[model samples]
Target: MKKEILKIALLFLSITSSSTFAQETLDAFLKDQPIIDMHFHITKGYGDNEIYRHLNVDIDSAKLYWAIEDYKKNNVVLALGGGPLKYAKMYAGAERLFWSGLIFPCTKTVEQDKPCEKEFYSESELREIYQRGNFKSLGESMFNYYGIPPADKRLEPYWKIAMEYDIPIGIHADSGPPVERVNKEERPNYNPTYANPELLKPILKKYPKLKLYLMHYGGEYSDQSLNLMKEYPQIYCEISAVSMFLPKEVWEPNVKKLFSEGLGDRLMFASDYFGTVRKNIEIIYNLDWLSEEQKRDVFYNNAARFLELSDSEIREHRKKLN
Candidate 1:
C-alpha cells in the first residue's frame, strides 16, 4: 500500500511539473517566436518628435538604437519604410532590415493651387530606384497626404511596376492619429478626409496581383477592412500605430472581431513607432481570448506566408537563435 501511494505521488508530481513547464509568460513566448514587422519606419534625430509629442513621449538617438537592439535580440526583422534610406542603411549587412521604396506627392497643401506631381520619385526615377535592387517593397505611400485616390491615373504605372516585380506595397490609408493631436503648424498638410479605406477598392479591382497591406488596418474601418480581406485574397492588414495609439476599448474589440471572424491568418503584427514595439507585443500577447496557434500566426506565421518565405528559409531563421 505504501508503494502504491508512492507511485501515485510520483505520477502527480510529474504531471504538475509538465504543466508548469508548458505554461509560459507572454514575454517568454515572444522570445522564442520570430516576428516580422511589416510596417516599420526609421526616423532620424528629432524628425519624429513632433508626432510623438502628441503622445507626450520624448525620443532620442539612444532610445532609437535601444529599440533596434531589442528587435535584434528578440529575433524581429523589419520591412522598413519611410526615409532617408541612410538610417536603414546603418543596419545593412545584418539582414535584419528590408528596404521599401518611398513615394511622396509634391502637393504641399490642401489647396488646389499646388499641382500634384511626384515629390520623392517620378515614375522614371522610381524605376531607376527599383533597378538598383535595394528595395524589396514600395511604400508606406501616403496617398491621403497627397490627396490622390488609390485608382488615380498618376499611380497606375507605379502599380504596374509593383506587379511586374511582384513586390509588396504598403500604403498609409485611413484616419491615423486624431488631427487635434498633431500641432497644425508642424503638419499643415494633415488631411483626414482622404484617409478612408473605401478609396482602395477600385485600385484593388484594377490590380489584382498587387501585393499590398493597408497600414494601420484601415483605422476606424474595421468592418470595411475585414470585407476587403475576405473579398481579396491578396489584401492583408497590419496592426501597427492603430493598435498602439488608439484607446484600448476601441482597438481591442476590433482586433477580437478579426480573430473571431477567422481572419487570424491574414493579420500581421507591427509597431509603427520603435518605442512602442515592446508594449505592442505585450498587448497582443496578454489577450486571453487568443489561442497559442492564433498568437503564433499573428507573431510570425502570417508574415512568413505573406512574404512567401520558403520552409527552408523559416527553418534557417529559427535555427539562428537555437
Candidate 2:
C-alpha cells in the first residue's frame, strides 16, 4: 500500500514538471518579441493552390478575416503576399507591418515551360500595377520554374526596370517539383541550378547596384549563395521554408556554419508561412543552439536594417506592441 501511494505521488510530480516546462516554453515564446513574417501569402481560393488547399477548404471575406485575426493574435506583422499581379494594389492595403509584395514572374500564363509571359512592362504599366504608393520592395520572385536560363538576355530588361526604380528583388532561387503534378511520371522541379551564382555572376557584377535577395537558404545552391554573399555585400538571404522543413538534427549545426561564414546579418527569419507559420515559429524559438539575441536578429533586427528603416521607425513599431 505504501509503494502504491509513492508511485501515485511520483506520477503527480512528473505531470506537474511536464506542465510547468510546457508553460515555460510558451511563455518564453510570447515574451516581448516582434515577428515580421517577410514571406506570407493570401489568395482567394482555398485548397486550390496545392499545399495550403489541404489546410483550408474555403477562402472568402469571413475566412480571410479569421485568418488575419489569427495572425494578428500571434503578433504577426505582415502577410508578405503572393498571387495575381493584378491584385497587387488591393493586397498592399493588407500590410499592417511593413510594405512588401511578391511578383511571381511565372503567374502571367498557364504555360510554365515558356519564358515569363510578360518579361518587361512599359513604365506606365509597372507604375500602375506594382508601384502602389509605398509598397517598398518587390519580392521573393520564383525564378527557377520560369523556364528561362539565368544568363538569358531577357533578364536584363527585368534588371534594368527594377534597378531603375531602386527596388530590391527577393528571388526564389531554389529548385523544386511543381507543387502541382502535371504528369504521372514527371518529378517536381526541385533544382536551383537555373539560379546558380555562376550564371548570376555576370549580371550581378554588371548591375552591382541591383539588390538581389537569395531566398530559401540559397535553396539547392547554398554554397553559391554563400559565395555571392561573400563577393557582393549587397546580397542577402532569407531563411524561410528551409528552416521549417529541416529537422532540428540537421539544422542546428548547418546554421552555425552559415552564420560563422559572414552570413549573420544577411540572414532574416521568415516563416514562409502560408500554412506553416505556427510550427515554424515554434521550431525557431526552440532551437537550442541559438542564443536569445541571435533569435532576436532572425526575428526582427536583421530585416529592419536590411530594409533600411530608420531607428525611429523601428522604435515606433516597438512602442505600439501589446
Candidate 3:
C-alpha cells in the first residue's frame, strides 16, 4: 500500500512538473515573439456591431478597447486591417496598423438584388485608391459571400493591378459561420461552390507572379489548399477565425496535416477580428505539436516574407514593439 501511494504521488508530480514547464516555455516565447496579424479587421464602423451581434458575439466599446489593448500586450508588431475606407482613416499614421483596401460592401445576404447602402469601390475607384499608395494589400475580399469566383471577370482588372503593383492579396475563400446564424434571408448566392481553393488555379496560371493568400484556408477544403500550395509556391494560407470557430477535433487535425505536409512556411497566422486576435494567438502558441521555429514562422516570419519586408524594416518594427 505504501509503494502504491508513492507511485501515485510520483506520477502526479511528474504530470504537474511537465505542465508547469510547458506553461513557462509558452510564456517565455510569447513575451519575446513579434506577431503579424495578416487577417485582422476593423469592426468599429457602420453595421459592424450588428454583424457581430448577429453572430451571437456581443461587442461593446469596452470589449473593443480590451481587444486593442490585448494586441499591444501580445507584442503584435503589425496588423493588416481589412474593412471599410473608414478603417484606414481610423488608424491613419498608427505605426502598428496597415490598412488593406476593402472592395466589397457588407450585406446580410448575397442574394440582395441591390448592393448594400455601404459603398463598394469600383475598379476605377480602386485604381485611384491604389495610386494613393496607402493600401499594402488588396483584400479579405469576401468574394465567396458574394458568389464571386476567383476567376470571375470582375476581378480580372484588380488581379492585374495587384500583380502590376506587386501587392499581396488576401482573399476569403471559404464558407464560415453557419448561414442560419447570421443570415435572415435565404442566401442563394452565398454557396461554397465558388469558395473551393481549386477555382483559384486558373487565376494563378494567368498571373503567375501575383502574390496571394487564401483566408481560412478554405474551411473544409484542406486537400485542395495543400495541393494549391504545393503546385504554386506563391500561394499561402492564413489560419484566422477558423481557429476559434471550428471544433478542436476538426481544427487540430487540419493544422497538423498542414504541418505534416511541409507547408509550415506557407502557413501564416491571422486573427480575423479584434475580439479573437489574442485567443487565436494563444491557441497557436500552445500547440505542443509545433516546433518553436514553426511557431515563430506562423506568428511572424511567414508574414514578413509574404509582405516582403526588408531586414531593416523588420528590425525597426521590432524596436517599435519593444
Each candidate: how many clashes? Answer: 1, 7, 0
Every model's TM-score: 0.77, 0.78, 0.80
The residue-by-residue lDDT of candidate 1 on 178-253, one tens digit each, is: 7777556535666665667677778767777888887787357777788878887877888777777677788778
Top model by lDDT, which number? Answer: 3
* Full ranking by lDDT: 3, 1, 2
Please write out the lDDT profile of model 3 over residues 1-322, one tens digit for every residue.
Answer: 9999999999999999998897677778877688888886654533345433443343334334554566787787787765556554445344444545554544434332122435345667678877874777767676667656767776777788889889888877666655556463645466566777888888888998989888886368778888888898888898777777777787678778887888878888888865676678878887888888989999999989988899997997678656
Q: What is the lDDT of residue 72 in candidate 2?
A: 67
Decide which is better by lDDT, 2 or 3.
3
Candidate 2, which ten residues in sequence have the lowest lDDT sum? 182-191
Candidate 2: misplaced stretches above 4 Å?
1-20, 47-60, 108-124, 128-133, 178-192, 249-251
Query: Looking at candidate 2, what is the lDDT of residue 293?
Result: 84
* 1-322: candidate 2 lDDT, tens digit per residue: 9999999999999999997897687667666777666675544544345533444444434445555666666666644554444344445665455455435454434432123346445556566555555565676565555555656664555666667777777777555434454332222342345756567787876788887777776346677778878888878777677666666555455566678885777777676655566666776677667788887787778777766768787776576565
Query: What overall lDDT, based on C-alpha atoms, would model 2 receive against the true structure?
Result: 0.62
